[model samples]
Target: MITVKNVTFRYKGNEETALNEISLTVVNHDFVGIIGTSGAGKSTLAMALNGVIPHEFAGDFYGEVLIDDEDTVDHAAEYFGRKVGEVFQDIDSQMVASVVEDEILFGLENFGIPHEEIGIRLEKVLRELGIEDLRHREIASLSGGQKQKVAIAAILALEPEILVLDEPTGELDPESSQEIFGLLKKLNEEKGITVVIVEQKIKLLCEYVKHLVVLDRGKLQFDGVPREVITHIDTFKRLGINVPPVAELSAMFRADGSYAGDVTLTVEEAEKMVREVLHDSV
Candidate 1:
């Protein structure tokens, strides 16, 4: 479990606080998505989760971030990094090796894992990400989605309990975005890894994340189940955040008293509701 308690932070030389007394909890195996407009501190919060806020960045940070009751401030970022693996928004910035297999091998070797076990971990993570075929491929030759996958595979090779990603699919197309979200869901359910992702795609979050957190100008605005949070359509609009299209459609119907159900987060849910209403009318 991760506990963020009333955390406030301001970067050195910056007058504005990047995070303001934010408090939240993420339990074991939770798949969480953070969404907000630009300068909303979404990326800052992701840094806090992985112990990068107070450790790597020069800043005035107040309050506590605990992982399973362990205080993050007491340890170096690298220490917590072993348990909370982070993938940055820029996939290329984190790549250290030329080949996919060597990239995954880099972390294991640096951690001083036995040479015999390196290959085992490498094969396992590749298979887990379904990227075994790309093992021998050059990092420069991979596409955006494939590069993102390789970046994630490199992190997953370390077997962190918590995976915090800062806009992993920002550059990918819609189909590729869905594939990444689906893969994260699979990892959360199958490996029981706690996933925290900062995503701009509202529809993807609604479909995959168990919880959604919204931030605005360094303050947390909304935090709850995606369906419930997206119900505040007006608030989202005020914040310049986009509500999922299906959710907007459901809200439109509800306004006219034609739909009596909760906000629909997905197209399938909307379709089912329509079918039910049609059946009742007939």
Candidate 2:
């Protein structure tokens, strides 16, 4: 479990507070999504979760972030890194090696995993990510989507209990973005890893994550299940966060008392609700 209590931070040489008394809890195996406008502190919060805020980033920080009962401030950045893996927005910047196999091997080798066990873990992660064919491919030769997978595979090899990603799909096309979310969902459900993702793609978050968090100007704006949180359509609009079209349609029907069903997060759900309403009218 992750506990963030009354945490606040300010970057060095910057007067503005990057985070303000933000407190949240992510239980084991929870899939949480953070969304907000640009400069909303989304990336800052992701860094905090992975022990970068107080340890690496030179900042004035207050409060505490605890991972599994241990305080993050008391340890070095690399300490929590073993338990929490982070993937940044730019996959290329995270790459430390030229080839895919070397990239995955680097983390295991650094952590002092036994030499004999390294191959097993590397093969497991490569197969888990379905990137075994790209094991020998040069990192620069892979497409944007492939590079993103390799970045994730390298992290997964570490067997971290919690995975934090800051806009992992920000550079990808719509199709690639969906594929990454699907992969995260699979890891969360099957491997039982806790996943925290900062994404601008509200529709994908709603479809995959069990909980939704919204941050604005370094403040905790909203935190709840996606269905409950999306109902604040006016607030989302005021904050300039996009609501899925299907959710908008569902809210429209609910506003007029035409459809008393749940808020639809996906197109298929909206279609079913629409057919129900039409059938009733007939």
Candidate 3:
């Protein structure tokens, strides 16, 4: 549904490129994850995909970004905003409404949807995220996770074809982070919306996202399965990407020939691996 070709960008007055010759495509209903260490260009790539790079942030942009075969540069930021729903790590920065329901309504109204339809969109989005009870509450009163979910609901109300999230759970506790990822997975798998998430929580993403892309120093260093990227412990260390604890444990088993399978990226997979080793010993 999206294509990026040989795209390189540098902020005005900056000598270095934020992204270098990056190219990739995402198909309909695809769940993709992009990961890298700080200053690796992951966030820059996300903004570029969502039409925020050159449209809102000035830069020396090179190459093109296309959505559904339409040149993103040809469209305004508002146009791409409807095609792509972006949830940033800082929910407050994205939110504008005082009430939860109004938060969802804001997008619909901006899209010029009819007044009657705004109500329908609001109800559907609140139900989809199961935040209906919080509709009347003040946005400032909600917790971090609740605020994040409301942020997502606001974007989801727009009914964008693709959802792009930048570290959506970076500030949440582990349980809340898990909930956020679970909601995103449900949206991708059950609702069939394309999802692109740039996150550092590789293990959570590995559990839900099948395709992974890795970046290093503004370069596309790796693109494939998360298991493939995480198993190369030495490379991950060199690139300053953290290998999840489960992946490290599985790596030890593989080194000893006690486990022979793809590298595990989630706790569930690690648990299954442990059970297999015990059964073999029995």
The clash count for each model shown is: 0, 0, 0
Q: What tens digits encode model 1's per-residue C-alpha lDDT throughout 1-282?
A: 899999999999999999999999999999999999989998889999978889989989999999989898998888887799999887787889999999999988887779998899999999999999999999999999999999999999989999999999999999999999999999999899999999998988988999999999999999999888999999999998888888998899889887899999878899988887678778
Q: Which runs in model 2 stand beyond 4 Å of their true positions? A: none
Please provide, for model 2 over 165-282, each residue's C-alpha lDDT reduced to its tens digit, 9 standing for 90 to 100: 9899888999999999999999999999999999999999999999999999999999999999999999999999989999999999999988998899988999999999888889
Q: After superposition, how far is residue 262 of candidate 3 from its true place, in Å?
A: 1.7
Ranking according to TM-score, highest score first: 2, 1, 3
TM-score of each: 0.96, 0.97, 0.94
Using TM-score as the measure, name the better of candidate 1 and candidate 3: 1
- For each candidate, the alpha-carbon lDDT, in order, equals 0.92, 0.93, 0.88
Candidate 3, residue 76: CA error in Å? Answer: 1.3
In candidate 1, stretches whose alpha carbon ends up further than 4 angstroms from where it belongs are: 276-282
lDDT of 1 at 14: 97
